[model samples]
Target: MPGLQTQSIHAGRSIDPSTGAVVPPLHTSTTFERDPDGEFSRRYAYIRAATPNRDSLEACITALEGGDETISFGSGMAASFGVFQALAPKDHVLLHRDVYYGVRELMEGFFAKWGLNHTLVDMRDIDEVRRASRPETKLFWVETPTNPLIEVVDIRAVAEAARAACALLVCENTFATPVLQRPFELGADIVVHSLTKYLGGHSDAMGGSVTLKNKPELVAQIRDFQHTGGAILSPFDCWLILRGVETLVPRVRLHCENARLIAEFLSTHKGVSKVRYPGLVNDPGHAVAKTQMKDFGGMLSFEIRGGRAEAFAFTAALKTIARATSLGGTHSLIEHRASIEGKTTRAPESLLRLSVGLEDANDLIHDLDQALGSII
Candidate 1:
């Protein structure tokens, strides 16, 4: 009610009714209590219909994005699928070439089976985006500061094009959390997230969400699908993610601070070829990022001197950072983009994506230096 920052901890939740606990309790019941007299019914009657924890989490995200409604799913991919289904079978989807790999896999597999046509375009170039559009282009999917490579796209420009074409613009707002950016404010129709990441800052839970900007009917449609499809997030995971959202602002501040240091270190290192981070003054997307995002996010990517072998070694040798995938957590992670991409030319062979954590800036820098020492 006060602001996004305050609501992150208190928006959809109040004191516990039964136990008077500060934090909300996880409701594990398959069904909720109904009015015995049948005079009135509670807000939700079943887990699929609704849950207090799920509603609370949704309210927090909706308030953060200034959205009208929010929906939860088993994972980020489920949320994406809901959007995919919301579109007609023949509708076209245009996405940034460098978005989440899972999305590419879905586009090539599941969505293709449904007769949906899509394209991967360099959205930073408005002309390229304009040229990629057909009269059938019904959805423009964007992942700014994109996965692995960290390519920044123009949200407002793409939104404008979608508006003119009477299409919907959906943005994966995982990297730039609501603390850093709000895509709906820039004209996004739907804002999606992998709550398993930043929103659940600890690496303990897996979930996803979608907040709607203006489509109440679409919200009902997705709710019906989610109810029938039953890819709903569990009570425990939703509660964990809700608790995780509480520290989002402070955690993001540290993540950006640590990442800025790592980006600076990597930029000047002899072993690194190119550093990709919006925080860098000379980064290709710095100006646009500065205009859109409140601050440069914690994720950055850089190319090592050699190819795959050297990149793997660099990641494996990191003492402080973990070698894994999926970003925006409390522990720093270093991943070889080539291995995860399954041999896609989209990611450079020598590239390493860094997910900076809330560690001491100096310790992270030293760990990176020592790791690079093995290959430089």
Candidate 2:
């Protein structure tokens, strides 16, 4: 129970009440009975409001993160949008420049004019982050070992930045998971996750969850927003995610090992111009990564020797590894980063991202070796 492996085994799950099943059953009921006085909103009154299945999933996440409250959403973007909506109109936010493409696009495009001002800065530079601060800034969104690039920004350092600016720091712990890194202890006010990826671990479910640090009112507001605004995950998806949680700890450990090996291999490969992973000793953020993260996680990116053509060739040459995006799944995945982000400058061309799954290390090495050999 002390370690992640043990915690994952028993956290946020149980047998059916009606039947003695070990795994929690999917409660598809839209409403639950209440007193006739209308004194209660009733359990599972509305699909959008709340459900036993959703609460069970939230409780598990809450225990795992040591957060007071957690909210589940239909998608990662919906959870993120809810976070923004909870903030004030005059709030200016400082965020990492290399965040997820969808969030970056949303912040720059729609939310910018929606009275929520944002400043995207290279978070590694403490001075730059300090300089970009605005008095009205309220949220500091960050992602370490960021999507595709694997840039490791110092959470504690940025947390200091947020504290000085009077902004609440929120870290996207999807890649590392609570198993690898606890943002709450690192001075983050909130933590976000795309359960569709690592939390689900199979990429079978699309869901998101957010955890608040000791903020009951904030938790209540997000819960209200989830209930009223209606982005709650389906009972089935929540149940699937609940299942994924049972193996998260063990899966993440293996993912980290596989990723580290691949990063080292890619670093020495002549076909790769650059490999971005905090686990590498030569990486600029390696020290900070070691300090903050329990492991460097399963995601790493390498720039192909040539531009888009070489990257495409290399990806197309993969055999066992799937040529696709999304991280922390059981099957290894390779993504041509530029293709998904369109015009966003966050993801670079010639860079290929890898999500090291539960596959054997040697097989993955062979796959990469063959792909690189064929790229020329």
lDDT of 1 by residue, 300-353 (tens): 999999899999888878898999888899999888877777865478899888
- Give, for candidate 1, the lowest lDDT window spanning 10 residues: 32-41
Off by over 4 Å in 1: 37-40
lDDT of each: 0.89, 0.87
Per-candidate alpha-carbon RMSD to the true structure = 1.3, 1.5
Summed backbone clashes in each candidate are 0, 0
Error of 2 at 96 (Å): 0.6
**Model 2, residue 281: what's the lDDT?**
93
Q: Give the TM-scores of the predictions, in the order they appear.
A: 0.97, 0.96
- The digit string of per-residue lDDT tens for model 2 on 230-282 reads 88899999988888888998899899999989999989999999998989999
Looking at candidate 1, what is the lDDT of residue 241?
95
Best by lDDT: 1
Query: How many pairs of residues in model 2 come into backbone collision?
Result: 0
